[model samples]
Target: METFFSNQKQTLSRAFCLSAAVICLGATNNAWALFSDDEARKAILDLRKSLATTQLELQGEIDKLKADNAELRGKIEGLEKQGEDISSSQKTYYQDLDTRLGNFEPRTATIEGVSGTVQPNEKKAYDDALKAFQAGNLKKADEAFSAFANKYPKSPYLPLALYWGGNSKYANKDYAGSISQLQSLIKRYPNHPRIPAAMVTLGSSQLESGNKIAAKKTFNEIIAKYPDTDAAKDAHQLIAATK
Candidate 1:
């Protein structure tokens, strides 16, 4: 009976130790699971923070690039405008230079049914003389016309200058000078458009110089050659007055 009791006690003690070991193992497994869950949560939070930081960096870079691109575009536009202004200025400068050059160059022009190449200085001289004559400065006109005739002897303006010079001389009451110029014109350019008018002046100059015989001869010649001209009528009147 005593030995049976002793075996029973030993079996009870073994069961108690096994129960304690199972309890300890279960507690250790639960603690490990809790630690693993905390570590996984921390890793997820860290990953999320890193992603947010990376996103912020990328956005900052994008903004900087955009600003840079805008600045570059503005610079390009400014350069283009500067280039256009430079081009315009160059064009204006060249045009002004060309106009200045044109003044010194010879050009084709027509004056009193005479077309030819005329130098700028030559045209200005002729125009100034003609302007003086038209302004009724008789002495200046005579001098200018005489100078022009002597200076540009081969000029197409010679005939007109001589004609005006003769008239100016006559207006100045220089009858001898008038006679000389008119006679020269009549002899040199007999078929000139101013011949009839010049001959009338010649006849009047002769009469004024107390040469009635020559004046009468000139009047008859005018009536014979240019009978329908106004100068011929003037000559007829002068002849009647002399009579």
Candidate 2:
């Protein structure tokens, strides 16, 4: 059989072993809890970093899109303005063309203190005849004026045309033709403003044609009809020369 002291010593050794086992288990559990907390904090930090980076990327993309959109809008506006300007320029160009074309159409006009309806080519005809006459193209002027008289019988330029044609004949030294034209004009337009000038031309043409008696008669008639006028002055000088 065992002694009592030996039994007591064994009981104390068993209690101490049990207490050491409990303390070791408690320390292991505390160490495991601290490790889990540290892992959770590290995971949270990594997740926050990922979120921040994603947000920055998203914001950068949005900013780029906004910039691209603004540039596209500006280009669109510029194209629209350019289109409008082209349209306006085309309109202006057409309007100018229309105005320029309208100039060629016939319209009523006053010529040589005479108001009358002129044809499309009437003014040009008269101007061409007058230009020919002024340029000393006497035959051309006569033919042109004669054609004008025959073409436009009731033209307001009739009296003037006949008058210039007679002058053209005179300048061409066609004394008989000049006298015929001047006499016809006198008989046709008795109250014409060009009568005195016509008489002067007729008398001068008669004198140049060696018809002194006819020339003297014409000058006397002019002096009787238009006294103190330029025609009368010319006639007085002629009559004195003839005498």
lDDT of model 1 at position 101: 65
Model 2 Cα shift for residue 78 (angstroms): 28
TM-score, model 1 to reference: 0.54
Residue 220 shift from truth in candidate 2, angstroms? 1.1
Model 1 residue 91 CA deviation (Å) reads 18
In model 1, state the lDDT of residue 218: 94
lDDT per residue for candidate 1 within 27-74, as digits (tens), equals 999999999999999999999999999999999999999999999999
Looking at model 1, residue 56 earns an lDDT score of 100
RMSD of each: 11.5, 12.2
lDDT of 2 by residue, 1-243 (tens): 469889999999999999999999999999999999999999999999999999999999999999999999999999999999999999999999865654565456555555566666776788899999999899999999999989877777888998999999999999999999999989988878888989999999998898999999999999999887899999988876565
Clash counts for all predictions: 0, 0
